[model samples]
Target: MTALTLIRHATILLELAGQTFLVDPMLDDARSHDAVEGTSNPTRWPLVGLPTGAAEVVASATAVLITHTHVDHLDDTAIAFLRDRSVPVFCQPFDVAELTERGLPDVRPVDEVTHWRGVAIRRTGGQHGTGAQADLMGPVSGWLLTHGGQQVYVAGDTVWCDEVAAVLDVNQPQVVVVNAGEARMVTGDPITMGADDVFATCRYPGRRQVIAVHLEALNHCGLTRAELACDAAAAGLEVTIPRDGERVSLFQG
Candidate 1:
């Protein structure tokens, strides 16, 4: 069985491929990080408090999967916590050197398809935003996790573009989780899935589960949970927006 528990922000405790994979852990107390400069809201990041203890969040995690090394995704506190544990840390090839330097002993890079244990982890492309903003944000990745005839796609920090469409068309994953918040910088467009993009994803011509995350925690993420829920209802579409620390099943087999 594959399931996901949203710890906070983009921090997801994913039970997949027969292991409990801690994905993009930003394990910090609320308002620990400074607010993004020039963002619309100058509020300190992680607006809400953690739903549970941070230790409880990492207790059962057998492995770690990082979409990127961005601070919001992997904070300094998480680094300290991970530095103590020697679990397998999976990431894109671009991040191997950095993670290794951070005292992570087992930094495994998933270049395209990596077979760990018995499951397959496929690294997929993502664009943080369009044109210059995307370039500035550098390279990020999505993931395709397959095992036991079940597939779960985690669309990390990306706007709806060819890369996302390709994943939907080709992989045909049973559960698709997109990082939606319409998170924006001062000048550019949203760096993550906005309302329209998420609606497009849900309305995609297929019977797949669409779950939205990466919302409400950060200051830059303008999309609120209530707003997204209202929009989803108005559009008559289905999208699972799990609360912080809430667990939801994405795929089961």
Candidate 2:
């Protein structure tokens, strides 16, 4: 059975195709790092702690998938956690050099589709922000994981745009994972999906599941699960906002 466990922030433990895949693990303790410069609500990063211990968190076998190398997505503790292990690290081309430099033995860049043990992981494009913010934020990638008759889309740090629309129209994944914290810098628009964007994703014409995450962890993330839940419910939109450590089914609901 395909399942997902939200570890914290943008981190997730995904079980699919008879293997476990850890995605963008940020395993540091609460408030260990300072706030991201220029972002609003200048509080320390990772406002909360992981639901479980790091060792227990990553004890399962399989590989690691990193969408980007942002501190919130990939930190020193997480890097140190994987250094001695022999799991394959799958990442976008932009992160290959650094991840390898960090001493990860099996660093693999998924420029496009990467096949592994009957699973297909396809790299999809996205805009982290608009204009200068987007450019400065650098390149981000979402991932489409397909195995047999099931498909799951892990939409990385991104806003609602043509690229996301195309992924929805073309891929038609039954389960969609969205970074919906509405995070932003000092003086710009939201860098991630807000309530409107999440609603847009849920409103897509089909039967599927929209899982909204990236909330209540960092200071810059202005939106909360309570807020999103109320807004979505009022708008008659369907979404699953799981708490940290909660395991969610990958099937459409």
Write candidate 2's Cα lDDT for 1-253 as tens digits.
7899999989999899998989998999999988888876879978999999987766774988899999899998888879878998899997999999999999999988999988899999888988889999999999999999899899999999889889899889899999998998888789999999999889887768999989999999999999999999999988999999999987734
- Superposed Cα RMSD, model 2: 1.0
**Model 2, poorest ten-residue lDDT window?**
54-63
Any residue pairs clashing in model 1, and if so which? none
The TM-scores, one per candidate, come to: 0.96, 0.98
Candidates' C-alpha lDDT: 0.88, 0.90
- Residue ranges of candidate 2 with Cα displaced over 4 Å: none
Please report how far candidate 1 places residue 213 from its true position, in Å.
0.6
The C-alpha local distance difference test score for the whole of candidate 1 amounts to 0.88
Q: Across residues 62-96, which tens digit of lDDT does each residue of candidate 1 receive?
A: 88889999998888888888888878989989999
- Cα displacement (angstroms), candidate 1, residue 203, comes to 1.8
- True-structure lDDT of candidate 2: 0.90
